[model samples]
Target: MSQILLIMASVRPSRVADQLADWIHARNTLGLSIETVDLRDWPLPMDDEPHQPKQEGFDGYRSEHTRNWSRKVDSAAGFIFLLPQYNWGYPAALKNALDHLYSEWQGKPVVITSYGAGGGGKAADQIAQVCQGLHLEPVPTRPALPLKAAERTDAGRLVDPAAAFAAQAADMQAALGELAAALHSA
Candidate 1:
């Protein structure tokens, strides 16, 4: 089975990022194994390591936390980043996480979902550039879920969810399908 890694960059508990991640995990139909990793839970100190990740490798990590983090990134097949636009860019934590691993991200397929005013267009673009630099294929059909239209019910579920973000979701899923096909063909 293909593995899809969901990286939740938002730290806010009530944020819609988690909801959107869960929604994607539930809707994926291609026997893709889903794993959600919240950056908040694995709080690492500023990158103060003596050597760079590419040079020292995961084994040379002085911190056990960093080592564990590297392992998770190394094991994933593809990634879906849940990014919220912060001043027209992706969060520092998300960038830091990406910087922590080099070899793991090479040639991986990455799909991004951004939420904010204007549907996180700025953040999505910024992240796409970073993904390209990392040698990861950033899918063109990125899904942007604007903050204005996301509805949260009293029960804590997103209301009118399917129709609310169907267009973007469908686009993302289609991109994932294409990525999967490419991986299989290779």
Candidate 2:
């Protein structure tokens, strides 16, 4: 089975991105292996490489962290970004992570599962453009998990991802199915 990395894009101390990612990971019915990559574990510096990722590519990474990240991205067949929209865009960590690698993302299918008050539609669109620049193919069904006032805490932590995002499950499932098909065909 092909492996798809579910990248938890938020690294905030009290963030709820992991809860949403866990819910999606647990509910996956497709036969593909879904691995969750918490960005906190990687802890990559923002744009620390001497050369641009395009110039050095994967094999020519100067930093050990970039090399490790390259290997991880290269090993995956597809990706699912468990993202949170911050100020109508994605987190800086996610942008930094994407910037750390280059060709490893080429031609790989990606599902941008964005969550926010407004469903993160703008963030999804923005990331799609970035993905295009890096040559990652964006799947058609981008799942947007919207959290209302009652769905999240005053501190912005998700109350219960499973219950809050129940309505968006079908979208997530469809996106996964599309990713699986894309991987199989690739």
Candidate 3:
């Protein structure tokens, strides 16, 4: 079975990033298992670990937190990053998460769903570049969920109760399927 790791980049409970992740997970009909890892919940510090990840062995790491994070990234066959534009770029927390690991991210498929002022499409572009540097293949057909269409609930969950966002979700899922197929074929 294909496993997808959804990285929730926004700390705000009601932010659009998590909502977009939920949308993808809920609408996934491809039998792919989706796992969401919230940046707020992980709370990994800046990449201050003395030893590099490759030297630590795939399963061995100094900190338990790093070990767990690395394992999650390693297990995923593909990734979906729910990014909210901050300062016209990806958030520091998400960058930190990416920096903490090396081999886990290499040669994996990645897709971005961004929301912010102006829909955060630019931030998605920037993130795609970063993924390229990591040797992760970023799918070309990313769907931007603009802020206007997304609503935040009082309890801090983003809700897109309309059918419009479904198209974007479907596009992402389809791209993921293509990436999964390529990975399995390789």
Specify the highest-lDDT model's number.
2
The C-alpha RMSD in Å for every predicted model, in order, reads: 2.3, 1.8, 2.6
Per-residue lDDT for 38-140 in model 2, tens only? 9999989978888888544335778888889999999998999988899999999999999898888999999999988878998999999999999999999
Score residue 43 of candidate 2 by CA lDDT: 86
> What TM-score number comes out for model 2?
0.93
Q: 153, model 3: CA deviation in Å?
A: 5.4
Task: Please give, for residues 137-184, the per-residue lDDT of candidate 3 as tens digits.
Answer: 887777676666655678655555346475466676677677667667
1-186 in candidate 1: lDDT tens per residue?
767688999876666667777777766777677789999888877886677776434457777888898888888888889899999998898998888767778888888888886789999999998998888887777888776676778865578667677767777678667667756764
Candidate 3: where are CA atoms >4 Å away?
Answer: 55-60, 151-161, 164-167
Return the TM-score for candidate 1, rounded to 2 decimals. Answer: 0.88
Model 1, residue 182: C-alpha shift (Å): 3.2
TM-scores, in order shown? 0.88, 0.93, 0.85
Ranking by TM-score: 2, 1, 3
Indicate the residue-level lDDT of 176 in model 3: 69
